[model samples]
Target: MVHLVKSATVPEYASITGVSLGLKDKVVLGPFEVQFIDVDMYWSRLSFHVNGPDGPKLYVVGQGESFVYPAADNQYLNITLTWIRSDTKTALIEIQSPLQKLLSGQKLNVGDTINLPEGFPQISIKLTSTSDTQATFLVTLPYGETQTLVITEGSGGSVRYKLGDVYSYSNYVYIHLLNTTSDGPATVDIYVPKVASTDFKIVREGEEETAPTTTVETVLVYNDLLYVNEKLPITVDNVTYYVKLVSTIPDVAKVEVFKDDKSLGSIILRVNDDEPKNVPNAPIKLSVQSVEPEYKRAIIRVYGPAGAHVIPILRPANLLVKIDASPKEMLLGDELVVVINVENLGRGDAYDVSVAAPIPNDFELISMTKTWSLKTFPAFTNMPALIYVLKPTKVGEFEIGKAVVTFYDDTSIETNEEKTIYSPVLTGIKVYGIPKIEVNGMAYNGTWGNYVTATLATQSASSSPLKLPMGTRTMNSSRMPRSSSACPAASMAQLRLMLEP
Candidate 1:
């Protein structure tokens, strides 16, 4: 049986409890400070001044009215005037930071690690190094990449990924320290992405369609505002659904939902529907939350089937292969060292891994394995370097093809399917022919000074030497003036000579 768990209607962002303040009184809430600037007796309204990372702003709202603070800022913030005193001398307000949070009751030692969401390992925070009052955290994010964050007590740091939106930090992971000690644990709080998971069954061809699997997990495919005529592509269980707002009439919206670009069906929804409606012939449910007819936009929540929307709760091995060629510029007959590094940054091991290194046409393998395989490579393991040497057979600019790696995902042992990934192509490899030149010079003593004869020769600087037709060469020597103390008769004579090569 499937259970429906409704998401919390409260704002996902953190909020401060209600605070009452009189005129000119200030209260610090998280990273921002709110000051009761003034009161308007005639209008039954109150004025507030807010100062935060986005800078200061003034807001005026009547009792029970709320206004989004930092209107000029990209983040979403809501400040509400919950209540006002009868005499208009003071007001009660609440502040919400839609993109940030302050976590509490988290304590960690120097070598402790914190996994966001408590158990799910999408992002990990490791306290690698620390001092009396400061600590450095190595944050390993998804896709096998890492970032360093250094923070002290009463401060915080965050890692933000690109979601191709104006407010890119909306879903960032944050870490804030509450207290710290040199030899003991540090108190902290962690703020990660707001993710909700649902469960469903994994139906097979021959088995009953109600096979339950507690291992399966689901993700929020789409939860945002969709504008009129805007086609939003949402992928669930490897199949994409194209949802478009056909049009809207007053409080009702006509939506066209398609499965794989093929028309599934059309549906009509009224603004602020209390319950969600299912799309025709699809394992998806959507509800029209609100509509702004003047703006031609609507806020819709899309949910995929519980079990079918699996996100691989079991970690899969992520292999990162890279090639590095040293001495970008080299000469023919010189050896180039090529190093292929393979790292498994995922949480699962890889099996039957094979690597195919590249060798350019103009280059010949000196010594090393161009292709190799491994039975198993564990996760978070940095394999030893696979080194190779090559000698250029021809002189010119060349590039090596990308390396190919094939491996089996340890998480999918039941399927035993093989996955292939390619490394980036190595570029800017230059080679030049050797330069061979010889010079000869002859000198003879003269009456006043010495006369010197020099010769110039030319030859092809290629693997195969080329000869040219014989030609005549000339050498000229100009006479030097007599020494200041020497007599005029002892001056040297000008000399001109001709030679053949």
Candidate 2:
């Protein structure tokens, strides 16, 4: 009955499901929640410190978390830990695709890479390839693994991805890749968020470009074929160029030549280019033998490609060799219009038949419209007569006097050869000035005393009389005077008598 007299003492221990070894501030995980457990707070004699490879262990005590590493000592027993299964399974895949040219008509080869974003510890790319007409590939990216797709063109060349898999936000995904086959020149179009449209262009080696020209002032002059006593002063750009002359004009040129305030000499200027540089300035001379009589036109000849000149025939006066007429002349600085009607009614095809104006001898040929051809017209049509514009200095009406037509064969036919200048049917303008007369408040024609002499009613249009009792004649739209009407309209009657001085 004395058993209670001797009592046994119980030892203090932690009854944890798994043994726990931790530092002072570290919490040890266990199978059950800890309520009150005895822990050896200070047992320095049995403990020794162990330093980690990293500085000062992971013993951090921040705002909400703390970490304390246990000290390694010979007396400390190892505590095994048990892990709990919170997540059963998870999958992640990584995929990458390169750029492609849809129209290249060649094989596509590329290496791709993709970097993972922050929140996704890993992701499955689930890549696919397609073409405008067909699909090229399909693959599910495995977890945490990179899937390499050949991206080769399939039955129908195209590379595409699963629509549902790609999440489109404000920004779209665009892939760009390198191209090795295109001579280092390539461009890829990408659909992305807020980027400027860009186009790339390439420049090849040899290209091209251009350059401009020059002109010189030149002058030509002449007098009749007659000899001159003095050299005419001719200037090229205001600079007197001593040249030999050729002229066929007669009795008009007052030639005087002076060099350095001294008389060089004077002579008839005929022709100049290609003449010898000797003989103290031979005052330009021209020879008729050098000219082809057939051109009826002047001949321009060149010895070099350096651009030459064609000297025109000159007539000093409008009237040259008039049979019974006086010499016709015009003053310097005056202008005149001389019309030469050229009618080419030839039956044969003359390829280059043209009109050549023979300005009276010694006259200066100023300007002209270009020469045209009769060949350009329809068969059997007449050419418009040539009109020569002129100004003269010598007052005389003589005739060198024949309008010539030049043929492409270097031959010419003068007006005399064709007998076309003498017009049998002649016409002149007649004006009338009738005294002011009115018919009862209706003005009959107040502008009278206006020389009133009418054109004789033609015996027939083909023939007209020079004199007739005057009356105003009105022509209808056809140009023949209108048929006699009951009412006489002198207003429409346009007949005026021209006074001869």
Q: Report lDDT (CA) for all predictions.
A: 0.64, 0.27
Winner by lDDT: 1
TM-score of each: 0.30, 0.17
lDDT string for model 1 (1-501, tens) is 111212222224544445667777765533456777777656487787777777898887888888775673555557788888766466777655564343557787776777666444356677766667776777754323356777777777666542211112322566776667776777767775332111112222244434223332222344446678777776666887878887776778789998877998888988656446778777776666567676576766566654334222244889999999988998778899999999998756788898888998888999996448877786668877888999988877889778899988746675877789899999999887665544534333444234433334445544433344444444443443234444234223322232221
The TM-score that candidate 1 achieves is 0.30
Candidate 2 Cα outliers beyond 4 Å, as residue runs: 1-333, 372-377, 408-501
Please report the TM-score between candidate 2 and the true structure. Answer: 0.17
What's the distance in Å from true for residue 172, model 2?
Answer: 54
How many clashes show up per model?
Answer: 1, 77
Off by over 4 Å in 1: 1-313, 369-371, 411-413, 440-450, 453-501
Worst 10 residues of 2 by lDDT: 1-10
Residues 119-142 of candidate 2 have per-residue lDDT tens digits of 311222222333332222221111
